[model samples]
Target: MDKAKEIFKVTKKTLLLIAGLVWSFAGFRVFTIGLEDIINYRGNKFISILVGSVVFYIFFKFIFLKMYKKHFIRITTSGLDKQYFFQFFDLKSYFIMGFMITLGILVRASRIFNPVGVANFYIGLGFALFLSGVLFFISFSNTKKIKVQ
Candidate 1:
């Protein structure tokens, strides 16, 4: 268990990615890099694609990992002796992941406002939907076993 914690600490890609995503989003433009070719390049519409991808990718790594642990608790609660913070964290992550997924879908679906490349934007949103759906389902099952202290 300690080793796994150490690994999570060392492999902080998710944290970095989230920070990067937030920064990128604040600076995003409708066609910062795609204006040159509105048809294929999508003009400024690609910003949504990149934002959704980066945001969802971070959630895939961190939020989904939390759901996996919650599922593990459900499948086999043998060794889980009514611990503390685990329960709260799992619940919190569950809802947050759901929100992220919903937000990603909205961001991608908003491509219509950009004037081009709606399909590419949705590609990123699709991954978020899939990742969030799996994680939420896993966590939902674990909710039944509250393991009260």
Candidate 2:
């Protein structure tokens, strides 16, 4: 029974990871198209990343604070030997989340202004968010002795 439960948990988590990848890939292509049309200046890209971080942070507040806060406490205490916690949610994750969210939101908002790149951005952002959820699960699994999700 325990084996079956473990198998089910792994399967569910794997499915979520795969789903996240597929959604993000599809959305990113659409976002690229939207950016080509709406982004008049390169500076907007950086601003978008910062905005994405805040957006992603807000979106996951519940899980981050309520469910996974203890993991963070452990990581901070674990020191360098267990630094994978830091690595799992490393700089790359943040930048990717930022870029994807920015592009997706830009796409959605541009619908009002009728920019060429606007629609794709929203689709992409939605998918990027899906991926972020998967990453959260992955990060959590890595830090905890048992599957917390």
Candidate 3:
């Protein structure tokens, strides 16, 4: 029983730590896009990122927090087995999640190759990837609780 509890605690901490890393990576991409836009386009991309972050925070408060609070409570109070937390993360989801993280890395790595020889296009692609990263973060955040529609 003690060993099981220790393993469970470690697993939960690892999961949360990974989530935090993903969140920070997404934030980094957003910030990088803003800096690139300012340097390349001389526009208000930085301000836009700030606005977007504020909007995301507000949305998370009203929606994600409410939804996930119930989920956390249900999972915690039900002896973990009732929730079957690991079952929610099947093989397919793992594959897809791995692909997303790999794609994000590849997108950032492309900056090194400069295969296109077009700076504007490269920056635009990066910004598009920045959007994708934000979407990835949102999707991953909600994966803990699968909603049936």
TM per candidate comes to 0.31, 0.33, 0.35
Candidate 3 lDDT, 1-149, residue by residue in tens: 86664544423323333434444465456446545644664455555455545555554566434433443333334443322234223466458658866865686567674322223333333344344344444545655643322
Best candidate, lDDT-wise? 2
Ranking of candidates on TM-score, top first: 3, 2, 1
Residue 47 local lDDT, model 3: 55
The CA lDDT at 75 in model 1 is 31
Candidate 2: stretches off by over 4 Å: 1-10, 39-113, 116-149
User: Cα deviation in Å at residue 57, candidate 1?
Assistant: 1.0
* Candidate 2 clashing pairs, residues 3+ apart or interchain: 34-117, 104-121, 104-125, 107-118
Best by TM-score: 3
Tens digit per residue, CA lDDT, model 1, 1-149: 87655543311222223323432342233223233234465245557567657755775577545554564444335343333323323466569747865775575567545534444444443454354444444444434443422
Query: Against the unseen true structure, what C-alpha lDDT does each candidate score?
Result: 0.44, 0.45, 0.45
Clashing pairs in 3: none
Model 1 ranges off by over 4 Å: 1-43, 78-126, 135-149
Q: Please report, as a residue range, the 10-residue window in candidate 1 with the lowest summed lDDT.
A: 10-19
